[model samples]
Target: MLDDTLKSQLKAYLEKVTQPFEIVASLDDGAKSQELHGLLTDIASLSDKISLNLYGQDSRRPSFALNRPDQDMGIVFAGIPMGHEFTSLVLALLQVGGHPPKVTDEVIEQIKGLDDALHFETYYSLSCQNCPDVVQALNLMAVLNPNVSHVAIDGALFQDEVEERQVMSVPSIYLNGQLFDQGRMSLEQILAKVDTGAARREAAKLNDKPSFDVLVVGGGPAGASAAIYAARKGIRTGVAAERFGGQVMDTMAIENFISVPHTEGPKMAAALEEHVKEYEVDIMNLQRAVKLVPATQPGGEHEVQLESGASLKSKTLILATGARWREMNVPGEADYRNKGVAYCPHCDGPLFKGKRVAVIGGGNSGVEAAIDLAGIVGRVTLIEFMDEMRADAVLQKKLKSLPNVDIILGARTTEVNGDGTRVNGLTFEERASGEIKRLDLEGIFVQIGLIPNTEWLRGSLVEMSERGEIITDAHGTTSVPGIFAAGDVTTVPYKQIIIAMGEGSKAALGAFDHLIRS
Candidate 1:
C-alpha cells in the first residue's frame, strides 16, 4: 500500500536501527543458531511496537532481568517460555515496557504492595522439562514486584554450585536464606510465603510437634490421602517428604483424574495438603528421607534418618516413594528438554496448543497422549519402536481416528533435534524398513516409561520388582516387619493418583494393625 519512496525510507530506517542491536548466540551454526538468530534479528528489527524479548538463556539465578536497548521494545520472543519461563517473559515485557499486561487488577495490587525483598534460587535441569515454568514465574515476580528476585541455576551447568547448595532436586528454590518453596508454586502462594514468613516461623515455634502412631513417606495423592484417612481413624500420623507433592508436582494439568474434570498439579497438591492439615498430624515438608533401618529389637520400632540429620522413630513405616520419569539420554535432548522436550503430556499439553508435536512411545501413556494432544496441537506424531501399538485397542483406535495424528510404527528415536534454545524436530529410524525420517515439530512428549524411586531401599528391608517397583502385600506390608509400601513405587498395576492414595490409606491401616499387634 505504501509508495516506493516511503518503502525505501522504512527499509533505510530499519537497517540503521538494527545496526545497534546485539545478537547473543550460545552455539555455532551447529544448532538452529542461524535460524533463531535470523528470527530474532527480524523481530528485533521491528518498529517501536513495545515488543518485549525475555531471554531465558540465563543458566543461573531462579530469574533475572534483561533490559532492552534505549529503543522502547519491538517483538517479545521468550526463548524458554514454557514452565515458569513463559510467565516470566510475559511479566518482564510488561514491566520493561512500563505497561502491565493482561492480568486481574487484584493480582496486580497484591504484587505492587509487596515491599520486602525475597530471592528464590531454584536448581533445575533442562531435562526436567517441568522446571522452566517455575523459573519463568519467579522471573515474572522479579519484574512485576521489586521486592522479589528469582534466580534459576541449571543443575547440569551449575553442578558445583548445586552441590554446594545441597540442591539434589529440580525446582528446589530457596527463599532468602531459608528454603521457601520447592516444586511448582503459584503466584499467590509465593506471595503469601514471603509476606507471612516471619509470622509463620513464630507461630510454628510455639506449636509442639504432634505425636503420630505411623509415619508415611511421600505426600502425593497417596500419602496425603493416607494421612487424612489415618486422622479420621483417630490415629496420630506424620507425613514426610523432600518435596510435599512428590512426582505429581511436575505435572502441568491432570485431566484424567476422576471426579475433577480438570485440575492443575499444584492446585491438586495444595488441596490434598490442606485436607491433611485439617487433621492432627505432623506435616514435615521439604525434608528428605536419607535411610531406613530396622528396629533394634524383634519388633520395637523403625528408625528413619533424614537428610537434615534429624531422626524419627515410629512403630510403623509406609514407603510411598513414587516413580520418576525416564530421560531420553540423547545429545541435545537434555539441553533443550524443557525448552522444547517434555515428558508429560498432561503437564505440558496446553502450551503446545495449535503447535506440531510428537509423542514418543507406543504404550498406553503414549497412545493416550497422542489422542489427547490431537485435540490441542495442530499435528500429533506418535512414534513407536514396535511394529504396532502396545496400548489397549480402544486407545489405539482413538489415536488412529484423529486426522491430525500420524502413527510411525517400528521407528526408534535416535536424536532430538533442537536449535540449542528449543526443540525444532526429532530424528527416528524405522526398524523393519530401515528408513530414517526427521520430523519437524514444535514439541516432543516422551512417554517411554518411569523408573521407580526405590533404589535407596535396595539393601534394606523391602523387595523390589524386576521393573524396580516395591513389592507389597494386600495390606501394603513389605518384606520387613512394621514396614509397608504404597503408591506407584509399589508393585501395583495402576499408577493413578487416586489408586496411590487408596493404597496409602490401606497401608496406614495395615501399619496400625502391626502397631497394635506389637
Candidate 2:
C-alpha cells in the first residue's frame, strides 16, 4: 500500500511530528506510530485526485484531506482515524469515496438535479456533544445531492467571528447571505426553509403599504398581537411589517405559549391575523417602515410619514416593527439561493420529506429542527462549523442520542447547487485541512442569527440596544412620550408569541392611557 517515494516523505515528516506524541511502535511492529505512518503512506500512494494536508497543530492532529477522482466527494481528517473517532473518520472517508452511508435514492436524485452553489456556515463549540445529529442531517442531504456544500466552524477557534456575528448561543446556521435558523433542524425542515427563502427572494422585492390608525412598525409576535389587541380596543390600527409575523414566523413551534400544546410559527401568525381581522386591524404585509419622521402635530394628534409616500395621523403610535436575519455576505451564497436554499424550517420543512437536507448553525433552534425532521425525512444532516455545540446541556444530551445525526467541526459551506427548478446540493471546504467537497441534497436549512429591524428609527426619539433592538421601559414606553414599543423589535429576552402578545397588549393599553391623559 506504500510507494517508496511517498513512504519516505511521510516517514521523514512523522519523525518530527510524533516526537511529543505517545509512540506505541517504531518502524517495526504495527502500533500507534506505525499505524499513523501507514495511513500517511496510503495517502501518498493515492492518485493526484486526492488532496491531503494537515489541520490544527502539526504536532497534534497531522491529518489528511482526501478528494475523490470522479464525484465531488471529499474528506478532511484532523486526527487519527481510530477508536472513538474511527467511525466518524471512516464514514467521512466513505462519503468522499461516493458511498454516503444511509441516504435514500430519491433524495440523491433530487440533489443531482441541483446546479446552484449552496454555501452554508455552521457555528458550534467542542463542548457540545449533541451537535452530531445536525451534522448528520447535512451529510445525508449532501450524499443524495452533490450541489450543496457545508462548513463547520468551531466557536472556540473562531472566537472573533462568534463575537462579531453576535452568536449568543450554539448551533447557529447561515444560508446564502442571511442568518437562516439558530437552533437544531431536521433534513426536511432545512429543505423547507431553503424553498421558502428562494420563493420570497424571487418575488418579494418590495413592501407595499396601506391605511389605518396607530400604525405599528414591527411584525413580531408582539407587534402582531398589539395590532390585534388595538383593533379589539376599537382603535383603527395598521400593522406594517418588513416580514410579517416578525421573529415568531421564523420559529418552528411554540411550546411555552398558553392555551396551545404546540403551534408552528406560521400557524400562530395566521391565528393572530384572524383574530385581528375580527376587530379592525389592517395589515400592510411585506411593507417596511423605512422612515419615521414625526408628522406636524395638529389638534394634539401625531402623524408619521412612510417611505411609500404615505402619511397617517393617529392619537397614538406603537413601534412593533421586528428584527431581520443577519447576513454573512460571503461569496457564492447569493448566486445559488432557492436552488438548494433555505432559512426557516417551520415554513418549508414539508417540501423535503424523505429528502436529504442540511441544517447550518449549532444553537438550540438548529438542534431542535434537526431532531424534529429526522422522524419524517429519509435523512437529516447537520453542519456546525464550530468545534462544539453550545446548546443547553440537557438539549445537547438529547441531540447526541439521536440515531441519524452527524456533526462536522471546522468546516464551512463555500457554495450552493441547483438546476434552476429547485435546489440540488452544496460544496464544503475544511477550514483546517483546506479540503473542498460537494454534497448533494434536496434542501438546506439555515439557523444563523437574528437582527433587530430598527434601522429606520436610528436617530429618532426611541432608544435602542447595540444590536438595533428597540429599548423600552417596563410599561413598553419608548423614549418619546405617547410612543410605545414591544415584541421582537424591542430588547426582550424570550422572543415568544405569548410573550409578544402580552407585551403588545400592554403597549396598546399604555398607548390608550397616554392618549386619555394627553
Candidate 3:
C-alpha cells in the first residue's frame, strides 16, 4: 500500500516508539476491506511494539480498536485512515503509546473539567486536507479523557451512514447525536462547544457594545493587516469578521506572497490572526456586519451594526470585506463539493495529483490553475465557454507551453457527474455543434471570477463599481470622507494577499491622517 520511500520514513518515525500499542482492524467482505487490511498489515510490520489483529466486521463495519488492552482510552477509528487522514492514524498510534497530546495545559484543564459524557462522531473523506486536523484534535481529546469518546468515520466507506446523517461535507462532526461543527475547526472552538454554558457566557461578554478608534470590517489578510497597523498607532482598533481567515482559509498552497517561498492558506490565516493578537486589536470573530452607517459629519463617528445585535462605533472605518469564488452552480456541483468538485486549486489540487482533472473557465485564474495542475497531475483539460481565451498573454503562453494540458473552447459545462460517493466524470455540450461530450476525470477545479463582498454597502454613502466592488482612490480613501476600503471587495487592480496587506496598511495610515485633520 505504501512505497519504499514512505516505508523508510515511517520506519524512522516508528523507531522512536517507546510504549506498546496494538491496532485491531475489523473488516468486512468488501473490496475496500482488502485494501485497508493490507495497509494496516504493512503499518503493523513497521515496528516491533506495534501489532495488527484482523476481525470480522460487526455492527460497526470497518472498525479499528486501538490498544486493545487499554480499552479505557476510548480511541477508535471506524474508517480506513488513508489520504490526508494518514497523519491522523500515525499520530493516534504515537499518542496512545504514551506520547503526550499536543494540546495546551488550559485545553487539558477544560477537557478534565468536562463531567458529562461527550461522544464525537467525525465524518471525513481521504482527499480532504482540512479533515485530518479536526480528526487528530478529536482523537487527541479522546486520549486525554475517557468521558470524551470519538469515532473517526470515513464518509466514503460508510456511505449509508453518511446519507442517513445528511453529511454533505467532510469533517462533519456530531457530538451527542447532534451536529457539533463542520469544516476546518480549531481545538479551542471544539472545547467551546463542549460546555454550552461557558460558550454562552463568553459570547455574552463579547456581545457587549465595544467602541474603537478605527473599526475594520472583515478579517481576511487585509482586515487583519489594517487592524494591526491601526492598533500599532495606539488607537482602539477592532476587527469584525464572520471568520477571521476569510477566503484565505479556503486557499491551499500560496507561493506569491513575496518573501515567503511557500505556505498553506490556513497557516497564513493563523499567522495573520496571531500577528494581530500581538497588538491590542479587539477581534470579534463569528460576527457579521449587517449594515454600515457612515458618519454624519467629518468629525462624527461611523457606526457598524452586527447581526448579533451588537454595535461598534469608530471615528474611522476600513472596509476589507474581501470576496468569494463564484460557483458554477451546475447539477451535482453542490452535492459533490468536497467529494471531488473543488474550487480552490491551491488547496485541493494536490489531492488530485497524478489523476486526470478538468479546469473550467478561460480567465487568468483558470489558466493559472491548468498550468499549475499540469505539473502535478497526469493530465489537465481546460474548458472555456468563450471561443477565445481571456487570460493575459503571458499566462496564456505559459499554459499553452504545458505538454500535458489540453484546451477546449466554446464548451458549456452541462453537469458534474458523480457516483454517489465522489465525482467520476463531467459532461459538456459544444456551443457550436450542440454535441454532448464527456470526460472521465477524478477532479474538477472551477476557477471562475470572484464576487466582491460589498453588497452590504448598498444604499450606503460608499460609492461602488458596477460590479458591487467599493471604489476607492489612492491612500484607500473611499467616496466617504472618513470611510476607507481595500482588498478584493474594493476596485483594486489586483486581488492578491500581499497587495491586500499593503492596501490595508495604507488604509490604516489614511485613517490616521483623517483623524489628525478632523
The candidate with the higher lDDT, 1 or 2, is 1
TM-score of each: 0.61, 0.52, 0.74
What tens-digit string does per-residue lDDT give for candidate 2 at 43-146? 43443333433232322233343444444432333324442233343444445544435645644555565666666666654333323334445555554556
- The order by descending lDDT is 3, 1, 2
lDDT of 1 at 354: 75
Query: In model 2, where is the ten-residue run with the lowest total lDDT?
Result: 17-26
Could you tally the backbone clashes for each prediction? 21, 103, 1
Report, for every candidate in turn, its global Cα lDDT versus the true structure. 0.68, 0.60, 0.84
In model 3, which range of ten residues has the least summed lDDT?
Answer: 344-353
Q: How much lDDT does candidate 3 score?
A: 0.84
Better of 1 and 3 by TM-score: 3
Per-residue lDDT over 263-316 for candidate 1, one digit per residue giving the tens place of the 0 to 100 score: 777667768877888988787765567788877676677777665556677777
Q: Of models 2 and 3, which has the larger TM-score?
A: 3
Using lDDT as the measure, which candidate wins?
A: 3
Tens-digit lDDT track for model 3 on 1-518? Answer: 88889888888888767788778778888877788888888889898888887863446767887764656566778877876788898888888877777666977888788888888988876766677778888888888888888889887677678657756556788988998877887676677667666556555676575667899999998899899899989988999897888988877679999989998787788799999989988887777788999888768889887765667888999999999988888898998887778776654555565789999999988998898878778999999999999999999999988899999999999999999888889999999999999999988999888999877788788999888999999899999999998899999887899999999999999999988888
The candidate that achieves the highest TM-score relative to the unseen native structure: 3
TM-score, structure 2 vs. true: 0.52
